[model samples]
Target: MSTHVDDADRLARVTLSRTIEPGDLRVTGLVSELGAGKVLGYLEAAGEVENHWGFALAQELGRVDPAQVLVQAAEQGIRFIVPGDPEWPTQLGALSNTGALHDRGGEPVGLWVRGAHDLHQFAGNAVAVVGSRAATSYGTEQASELSRDLATMGHTVISGLAYGVDQAAHRGALLAGGPTIAVLPGGVDRPYPAAHAQLLDAIAERGLVVSEAPPGVGPTRTRFLARNRIVAGLAEGTVVVEGAVRSGAINTAHWTTNLHRPLMGVPGPVSSAASAGVNQLIRLGQASMVTTAQDVITDVMTHAARAATGAEQLDESFVPDPVRYPQSAGPGPAAGISASRR
Candidate 1:
């Protein structure tokens, strides 16, 4: 059974979800200090403030009614899980400590989830596999095989529902008869990229479809970037199969590393443009190289056990060394064209 939340608190968080963008530190600080209900009340009462953020909050409050948003969400089979709810994934609280990544940091006020599985349980042992939307055949195959092997080992696979690598990873988990979670940039009710609607539906049937946005919202470039933090936050580790230097997968990898979570990258052919980001990550000591499911599981579980036993703090030497780029290959200009254009 689901845990009960107070009507006012639930309404406040739902209202905030619609009004404030995810990871807004200013709003998060206000809510943390005054509570969501009081923050909403303050917003409702404020006339105008000189600050841009304050002005925006007041304007947003004028147009939204929490009660109506709740009604719409319920009608669409979506439930809002707040910070203390039984279904909330507590691991996400780690975001609160991410000081400089403020644009993509701060704990979400709540999540809009559509699925049967418990969110906390579903995320407890998950590993995220993300990569290029324009992945090569080798990248797609590697993502699928790794996802399948991870699933067979009882790990839940998590990914964005984009084309190429993300799609292949989700499919591999399904084919292995394992649960998979899809984190969306838009509302849980609306699938972005329209083409992946069926794939998103299939994932929700077995696992979950999650979003920080409310039911009627659509994706934006900022929202897509912000969404990567959640993908990294929910998983025990993150793997980038293939991407350019500035792709979304690399963004997710940065979040994983910032949170001190296990970050891994799979190598592709040295000649492949798609492998550039992963190769760069490994070369710069930003991530470790992982070729197989066992490699990922070993790293994840070792870190988990270390954290559990406080060995991570007591002895730094016990932790695995960062993987280095192979010295055998002669260095040239890094594999792909500059990602600034992308």
Candidate 2:
């Protein structure tokens, strides 16, 4: 398949992403049907979007300048990748088939990528390792070991680049001399936890850093939820090393299960609150128990590639309970932004 998208469409996507947050299914549906340029035109000419936040962002079009955005990104060694771009990961196509979880679902309109690796190659056959931002030592160690072994065995690791387990997983992949992918909730130009800037730089040198948010944007709760889906979508399977009952990793696990990918949980001490969510998942039959890297590899390999085409395996009526993202607020940039332009 050719990966050449028109520059005009690419520029339109940049503007759209600038005005919209990632993973707005309503807008994604429109983009899937009308094309980015046409969709932007529609928003620009008039707010024809019905009962959607996109209508709210229709006025923000004047603030978006795709050409300037591209220039700024280029200066920072970042590239904007639209759907048909050569570096676009085909695995993300699976997201289009998955149902909403926390009201955020759909393929991203564009991705802001940094680092040397091509997302198309690394994402499709990867394994996601995620957990709480405030993980326990045991959790981080297990995530690290699992990622290290998976890397040594030639599996690319994908994570959300958060604190705790996410950081450990990336470090493990790097230590094993394997490429890893970090999906962020903010712009590629700015690392969310500023303290991890050096780590982010190191990953960029050896792997890839990706985000759906355009450059200059910051992270938000909804953006983090959206980023979780991409982490699940990029990989063939996912492992939750540890998660609080209401943590983002649990959110990611739901995305994995809903996507029909294999979901594995690393068992922690019975009393550890950090592992509560993981234990709950395993106990509830939402995830299989996995203790070692080999166990993870076995399960992941046995069920690999299903996430990208497992519509039959997934329950169309499935709805995740204990929603983490706030239902009262939309996953937009600001109060009225509403990820509206995509």
Candidate 3:
């Protein structure tokens, strides 16, 4: 917790490296104690760590040397955000059972963040809007509009930097001149899909691009799953724009539900495959419907007011179809919308 320790960062990195491959009990025991940089320092300090559990773990699993990773990150001018640090996101720490990791056991111990933006301002009152990679034009527009409205209303917007809905959310917030944050599945330096490099750069310059992974790491299926949790954890609520039943956005919705955060979904035409997951959430009572920024703001405010007042039942009347699109008010897209619209 002390940020000024001389050798602590190096030890943290060593701990990270030693927890891999054969996995040293000594390093593993220190996992919860040391931060990422300190762990790596411990590994290097020992000098005998090459291929001894730590090296193999980094090599096989593609985990970078915590110290080396930090150096690379610093080269990119990225800051390492550790738990209990000034810049560490407090909302994420709410998942104590998950060790303050993002999402429901998906996020890592700390994040490597690159940007001049203040994540705290966004984290305290943020909403995540996520959906399918293959988004329809209508879905994209709705996502953008939702993001714009959220930003205009002073809510921080959070999302993955993936194609379709993810990209739209970031763009919308930027276009609206609102603060937004992109949670990457890989290291902040590794922009997945490679196509959104410019978008990622814009985010880092104007907002923030964050990742829990050490630097130099690339995207993997597991990392993608992990990224979703950070998206959910950073926000007070989440809105599913468009996605299939088994889509990653659905995973985020589930995480939101588990976190007791309000989950909202923008309904698409029933015939649209992208809306299937959201519609299903609505049907299952997992998420409420949200069509406009007003709906989201009202719900969030109501929840906050109730919590402050120690009320058991928060008011849900501000939204029309509380279960379907609670306060949603938008034209439904045509059925069979393509994912590319996003």
Best by lDDT: 1
- Please identify which of the two predictions, 2 or 3, would achieve the higher lDDT against the true structure: 2
What is the C-alpha local distance difference test score of candidate 1? 0.82
lDDT score of residue 25 within candidate 3: 31
**TM-score against truth, every candidate:** 0.88, 0.86, 0.77
Q: Give the alpha carbon lDDT tens digit for every residue of 1-342 in model 1.
A: 566668788888888888887767777667766788988878766646656456767787767788888777878878889877889899988877765353656778889999889989989879999999999998899899889877876789999999999999999999999899999998998887799999889998998999987787899887887788999999999999999988999989989998999999998788888999999999998888888776776667566757877764434344432221121111222212121211
lDDT score of model 2?
Answer: 0.81
TM-score of 1: 0.88
Distance from true location, Cα of 89 in model 3, Å: 0.7
Model 2 agreement with the true structure over 52-158: per-residue lDDT tens digits: 55667787888878899899899999988878777788878778888788878888898899987778888766899999888888888888887887787677899
Model 2, poorest ten-residue lDDT window? Answer: 324-333
Candidate 3 CA-lDDT value:
0.71
Per-residue error for 27 in candidate 2, Å, reads: 1.1
RMSD of each: 7.8, 11.9, 7.4
- Candidate 3 wrongly placed segments (more than 4 Å): 1-68, 98-107, 314-342
At residue 194, what lDDT does model 1 achieve? 91
